[model samples]
Structure formats: structure tokens, C-alpha cells
Target: MTPHEIGTTFYAYTAASSSVAHILDASKPATFSMVNAHKRLAILIHGFTSSHEDSHLQSIKTNMLHHSNGEVGTVIVVDWRHGASALALPPYLRAASNTQVVGHQVAHLVEELRKHHGVNPHNVYIVGHSLGAQSAGFAGRYALSTFHWKLGRITALDAAAPSFENHPGTFLTKNDAVFVDAIHTSASKDHNPLNGVFGFVHAFAHLDFYPNDGHNQPKCHNPLEIACHHEAALLYYDASLSAHNSCKFYGFSCHDWATFHAHHCTKHDAEMGYFADKIHASGVRFLATTEKYPFCH
Candidate 1:
């Protein structure tokens, strides 16, 4: 699809009580200036079949505002729902193909911020879920390759694994940004029937966090609860940003899950979610969580 054919909307949220404001029309360059250059910018991308209006996305935005203590300058929700609504293979393929184009468009907006508005690329953070996570990677890659700007960070919430597992460099990676952290909530398990229920099992970021083994989460007993597991990535991220978060998601550095489970791998420690501090670490890390609400604690 051409740049004109892709429909991406940017909604700006300034405060906790603030209603979403349409700040940018992707087709119109003039509207790009509506982005506030003074405040730190956060761009959120939702997964397939979801929109900027998604409840999970809203929760994260609200919590981020609350956690930042009004420090968060601006929150931009990237709506590419038109390309992500279809559940079939063809639509998924279309969405995947459009990822690069959307990334270019986003990079262009950031460039406008830098050139005209004086926004620092280091203050921009991109957060995405599932397929949206892959899109975030593309945006980071495009920003550096096309604009020579390295994004501050990219948070991938259980990036999709179905079509992207074998395609390296197609999804989020550590090199996409200065710091890339991923939360794998639902990955395929050996001899398990509910494989590929939500996320990719691979370690796609500098710090790949596997919460509750990153497969079937606690309290998720049925297949229908897949949303719970998939959405957990966002929940953890939201909690990590919330001031009320009392539980810290500490992970153990391990070569793999087997070594982690066998207690053979243990050398360094890492933190997960919004406040993750180990941006320099590489490889998979394991952590545990509660079965109920406020899963972090």
C-alpha cells in the first residue's frame, strides 16, 4: 500500500483527566506541529483487531499519566485499526506489509518534531502490543535508517510469533532502539495444545522478560482466557508505571527456560516492565507473578 493509502491516526492525551485530542492527520504535514515538543512523548500502538480506543490501551495511558506524576509530556495513540481489524491470513499479511510504511510515516512525524519543534529523539518512547509491537520495531528501525535518529526506547508487549518467528529482522529487536524491552506473556509450550495463543516465544529485545514462565499465566485455566494472558503484558507495564505498584518484577538472568527451571543459570538480576533498569543486558530473563488482579504484587 502506498503512503496515501495507509490510514494512521494520532490521538494526543495530555493529562489523566484529559480526553483524547486528535492532534495529527497523517495525510496533512501541518497537523504534525500539533505535537508538543516541550513534554516527553510516548507513542502507543495497539495490537490486531484493536484500536486506540481499546480499554487496555486506555488503562496504560491513564496509569502512565498517574505514574509519571504529570511528568509525561504527551501520549500519542497510533490508530491503524483499518489494517488490523481482519483476523484472516490475508489481512494479517496486509497489516505486516503496511508496518514498514506506517513506520516511515511515524518517523517523518518525529523528524518534523525534531526539525521544527525541537523535540529530542531521546525523549520519545514507543510502546506496542502484539503485532503493534512489530510495527514499533519498524518505526524505530526507520527512524535510525532514514533519519539517523535513535529512539530512546521501544517496549514490545508479547510480539506476535505466528508469521514472524522465522523472519528475523521483521519484528522488534534489541538494535531497533537504544533500549528495547519485551514482555512475553503467552508463548507456545511443548506438548501443549494452546500453542501460539498470543505471543512469540523468542527473545526479541535486549531484555526479554518471561513472566510466569511466559506461557500459560496463573489463573488462566481455559483457552478463552487467552486474552487475560495476552493482555497481561500491558497490565504489567501499566503497573510498573503506577505509583501504587508495590510489587517489583525481578528476573533472573538465564541462558534459557530449562536452565532457569533447573536452577542451573543464575548470575545477574534484572527488572521488568515500565521501570526496567537493565537495558544493557541481553538474552531471556524469567520472573513470576500473582494469579489475580495487581499481578505484579
Candidate 2:
């Protein structure tokens, strides 16, 4: 078996003190030589209060290192300059309130990647979760309009519906990527219909919904449930493996938290780790197929 190779690139940014809006970041082009050369390039943005190595992106990076056929690729982790110094949850909430700034940072990074590495626009992919997802969408929009940088695909994993819905350009209708797919965890009971995200739901080239509330993903400490949702996302993403089909939606069910909490299911951090990995694997499969590969080569 080939050993997996992985590397990280950091981006620096300056934003208004009041909001984390990206002002300027120009050093991204210098970091491409540090990336692994065996897989498709992946740009992973961490959510607010999270590190560049957050579990969401790290797990996927691990998977790609091992699974990518002899061609390793770059994984750029965009660290919010002040994000590391702030409290995790609270700042995430505050920062998420305005995601366009982060998106601007992503747009800058993408341009640098193109100019420095000469990466084909169609070979790059963006992956994000929650606020990060919103950032990915924002970046995709900016890239399209400014550079006409078409992407192979963009995947938003269980993104918070706030920026996704309320913002016009975040969804496909506003500035659709060459390919866009979203997986919103059904774990939230408060999916306000009045919110723009609900309306934006229909714009994804492909969309997936879990049966549980936004917080109730598999491994709400239940291995069985985790396996199920993992399988569901895997299958849903796999449907596009042939590259001939357009995007679609998959609605899956995991144990609802209301029931889990009501029944007092034993909560284990270990179990949560399991499910997170499963979900990440599902994401990896989706990403692998979206690029130009030997199968499509």
C-alpha cells in the first residue's frame, strides 16, 4: 500500500476589529509547494473558534492521504487571524453572523492557488462545515464572478442555514458553481421556514437531509445509527461517481436527540468520534469522484 502524504498551508488575514471580514491576505501563493502531490487539492476552512486542524477537516485529510491514488494534493487550512485567541463557541456564533468576510478570504486563497500552482480550476474542491460551509459557498461565488474560476465541485457539510439562506449569492441560484452539492444535517428542529436557507435548500445541485435535528447526527452515541447515516451519505455521494448524473437529494434518519435525551441514552465522547469519522469518510468519497481522475482521465 502507498503511504499517504499530507501537508498544511496557513493563510494570514486582517479584518475590521468589529467584524471578521477579510481585508487582505496575499501570501497564499508561496505555500503550494508544501502540499502533498498525490491527491486532488482540497481547501479546508475551519469554523469560527476552531483550528486549521479541526476534526471535521482533519479526518477527511487523513482519509485522502491514504486513499488517494499515488497522486497527493494540497490541503490549505485558512486560519482566521484572531480566531485562535477567542473563545470557541461564542466567537463562532458571532463570526458566523457575518460569513461573507471569511468567504472573501477563501476567494483570495483560491486565486493564489491558481496563480501559484497553476492548478486547473476544475481540479480544486472546497469543503466546509457550519460557518465554514457558508464561507465555502461565499468563496465559490466570488471566484466565479471575479476570476471566472470554475471549480470541480463545492461541498457544504451540514452548514448552518443562516448565511446559506439569507444571503442571495450563497446558494446556487445567485452564483452557481460549475458543480455544487450540500449536505444539511436534519438534526435541527428549528429549521425556520421563514429563513432564507430553507428557500436556498432547493438550489443545491445535490442536497441531503438527516432524520435527526441538526445536533442529532449518528453517534448521538449509537453505533448502529452512526453506521446508517454514514452509509446513507456515502451512497448519496456515490451516485455521482459516474459523473453523468446531475445532483439530487437524500433524506436519511438517525435517532432524534429529543428521543435520545428523553430516553437517557448514554452519551460517550468516543461514540461521537466514531460518527464524525463516518461522516468524514462519506465526504471523502464525494470529493474523490468530483475531480478529474484516472477514471475520467
Candidate 3:
């Protein structure tokens, strides 16, 4: 879809079974008033060729709601599938172009929420995967530039690498939000042509968590693992929000994977996933995980 033809839709999901409301226009006051933000609000964005109804998004939504313990006021799913649809232009190019448009729309929505609904910007969190992750950064950047509003946090799940790697300021960065955390999975070292490419290898966020060296997730060696490792980042985040918060994906501060593997790094400060705390220190963090389900210990 072309930039002019982009259609950005918002769906609000709350505890009420009938709370699924479609926001036709984000710029209007009516749309903001419709949202019931009694607690924190989470805006979930999907990647290219994905939608609000995708299984991965649904799973993340379910986990967020289930673990919030009624503290989550609402979950807004940003559906920009039209803009992300495959077109004659390269898929990555299409996504890159759409990011600005969709980001503006999302920023407007947040502005409206703060202005009309009295929703605090600090109570808003954005979680996006793959190309959507880059779009989230754009949204945060727009919010700060246009409204001077800093988002609470932004969690990037294996942000897309192609067309974004080395393109500083084009994709997600620590400056996008007050606290930006990135989970790097399926990242290709040196742009390895043999490995399946999905996520960026460079550390872009304040807290960059690398699980299993950030590549070739166990049990995902086959061709069907298109987004297997990338998607695992979401699952890992979900696990962090498990009931009672039993799982903790502890991360150790490290300058590089080589030093981390060599046991040279000793400071373990950052915790990967939902319950992650905001730390002043910034650097690459390494953490190990199990190959089976309940990967986090």
C-alpha cells in the first residue's frame, strides 16, 4: 500500500467482554474518550504481513492481560496491515516508508489520550515486534517531537535488521522513550548470508538483552522457523509477566558476546522481559535460556 493509502486502525481491548471498540480516527477527541484507561495502557504493534488478529499478537495480548492482575486498563492493538502489505516495492522499503505515517498516527492517538482522556504519558507502554519495532520508535520520536511527551517505555522484540541496521536514527534507539529495552533474537553476525536474517545485531536500546548469543535459537534449525527465534523474544517477555512473576531472565552486563562467553563480565544488573527495572547503566547484556518451554529460570 502507498503512503497515502495507509489505513491505521486501533482496537481497544479491556476486561469487559464488550470492550473491543474500533477507533476509526485517532486524531479526534471522540476516539480518545472511548478508551477506558483506569490503569496502565499497553499499545501493541505487529510486524510486516501481520495484523491484530495474528496468533503471536493475540498470545502477547492474552499474556499481558492475564498478568496485569486488573492493573492493565486497556490494550490497544495498532493495525496498520494495509501499509505493511506486500507491494511491488521491496517489503523492507515499504515497511520503512510506512513507519513515518503509522508513527504519526500513533503519536496523535497518544496525544489525544493525554489531552482528552487525562491519560498520563508515563502510564503508556509500547511493545512492538520486528518492523513494528522500528515503527514504535518512530511513534515515540514523533510523540516527543510533536507533543514533547516522553513515553514510559518501549520494548522492541527482535527489531528488524535489513534496511535498518547501520541506519542510525531510522530505527529504534534508546532516545525513543524514557526507557527503551530491546530483546535481540535471530541477529546475524556481520550480516552472515548463511544464517536466516531477522533481527539487528547492534545494540540500539538502553538495555540490549541477547539470549543465546542472539542467533540460531535451539529447536529452530529448520526452514519453517521463519520468525521462530524472533517470536521467542515475545514469549520470553510473556514469561516475565507470568503469574506471581516467578521467571526472571537475568542479564549480565558485557561489552561484547565474546567477553560475556569468556566469563569476563561480572556485573549482572539488567533483567530481561516485562518486569525489567530501569537502570542507569547502558550496554549489551547476555543471558542464557533453556531450549524447551518456560525458557526463563
Candidate 4:
């Protein structure tokens, strides 16, 4: 699908001034007069059938604003709703095909930010969920191949498994960024119907976190527990953004939950979400959370 047909839009926000926000028009890029070049730039991308206004994205935006604390930072929320909302038969498949267009567009935006606003590509942090996560990989790859830009970090929240699971060069991978991390909360084991899930059960990042066994999340009693499980990834991430360490999730390196529960993986190897240790955190990791909100233990 073409970009014009997809109709992507960008919304820029600076914590310092609500009045200085950038809006709907694609022709007018956000002016970073208040934001300095070296400051962190966060780009939050929502999944298929989701928009920039999704609660998960908004939570991160709010949390980022709090973390930056009126500092010189920019949080740009991408909305490709038109592309994500295809109404034809097999709509999800159609939406899945449009992710590449969105990714290239994001790369273009990053190039502009670096060229015109003095923003550093290495300072950019990409946050995306499901299909959005897949797009983030594409964005990272496009930036590197087309513009020679290596993004600093990319966090995939339970990256969608349907269209991307085993597809080479079509899914999120560790090579997408300098430090790519993934939080798998609702991973599926399609091999057994009883253990079906929504996310890929494979390790797709330099650091992969499978919280609560990566499926059957606690406190999920919905009729479709799978959905509740799928959503827990973002919520867990959102809670980890709190100022208080009580909610900040610290994970341990382990082969699996059984190994983690065996009391072998005791030391906290890395913190999840915003505070992730880009230095030491690598390979497969596991963590536990409460059955309710403020899940971190």
C-alpha cells in the first residue's frame, strides 16, 4: 500500500509546553525550538487496529513526560489508523502488509528530525506494540540501510506473532537497533491448543523478557483470557515507568520459568521498560509480577 493511501500522521509533544504542541498537518513538522538536540527522542507506535490515542501509548507518553520532567525531549506519537483499519476481506492481512510503508515513513521522519532539528539518530528510542513492533524493526532497518542511521534502542511489547512469527526479514529482531529488547507477556505455544497464545514464543531480541511464563498472566479472568494476557505487556511496562521503584520490574536471566522458580536465577539482572540496562541485559530473561496493578515484585 502507498503512504498516501495509508494516510499516516504524527503528533509531537514537549512536556515543557502544551501550547507548543504539533498537530495534524503533515506539511508542518514539529518545531523543536524548546527541545535540544541531545535530549532523548521517543517515538511510540501503536499496533494493528490501534491509533496514537491508545491508552498504552498515552500512558508511555505521560510517563515519558514525567521522566523528562520538563527537560528538552520530544515524544512523537504516530497514527496510521487509516492503514490499520482496512475493511476488506481478511482486513488484518491487508493491515499487516501496510506496516512496511509506515516503517519507511518513520525513517523519513527521523531523517528530517536529524537534519533539520539537530536531533541525533543515536538518541532516538522506539516503543511499539504488536504490529507496531514489527514496524519498528522495519524503521530501524530502513534507517540504517537508506540513511546510515543506527537507532539507539527499540522495545517491542509482545510483538504480534500471526503475520511475522517465522517470516525472515519480516519480524522484529535483535539486529534492528543497537540494543533491541522485547517483553513477551502473552506468548503462544500453538503446538498445543490448550497453550495457545498471541505472541511469538521465540527469543527475538538481544534481551527477551517473558514475564509470568509469557502467558496466562495473573488476574486475567476474562472470557478471552488471551486478550487480557496480550494486553498485560503494555500495562506491565506502563507500571514500570512509575517513579517509585516498587513498580519497577527487575528481571533475572534464566532458561525458563521453571529454572527461574528453581531459585537459581536470583540476582536481578536487568530492569524492564524505561530503565532497562542496555549494557548488561542480554539473552533470555524472566521476571514475576503481581496478579493486579503495580505488578512488579
lDDT for 147 (candidate 4): 98
Clashing pairs in 4: 188-197
Give me the runs in candidate 2 sitting further than 4 Å from their true place: 1-25, 28-30, 36-39, 70-72, 81-93, 170-175, 186-189, 192-203, 207-218, 221-297
Instruction: Return the lDDT, model 2, position 148.
Output: 81
Q: Model 4 segments beyond 4 Å from truth?
A: 18-21, 24-35, 68-72, 191-196
> 104-195 in candidate 4: lDDT tens per residue?
88888888777777888888889988888988999999999999979998999988888788788999888889989899977867623234
The root-mean-square deviation over C-alpha atoms between each candidate and the true structure, in angstroms, is 2.8, 13.5, 2.4, 2.5
Location of the lowest summed lDDT over 10 successive residues in candidate 4: 18-27
Candidate order, TM-score descending: 4, 3, 1, 2
TM-score of 2: 0.57
Top candidate when judged by TM-score against the true structure = 4
Assess the local accuracy of residue 131 in candidate 1 as a C-alpha lDDT between 0 and 100. 83
Colliding residue pairs in candidate 1: none
Q: For every model in order, what is the number of clashing pairs?
A: 0, 14, 0, 1
Question: Would you estimate the TM-scores of all the predictions?
Answer: 0.88, 0.57, 0.90, 0.91
lDDT of 2 by residue, 159-205 (tens): 55544555655543224455555554432345553321221233244
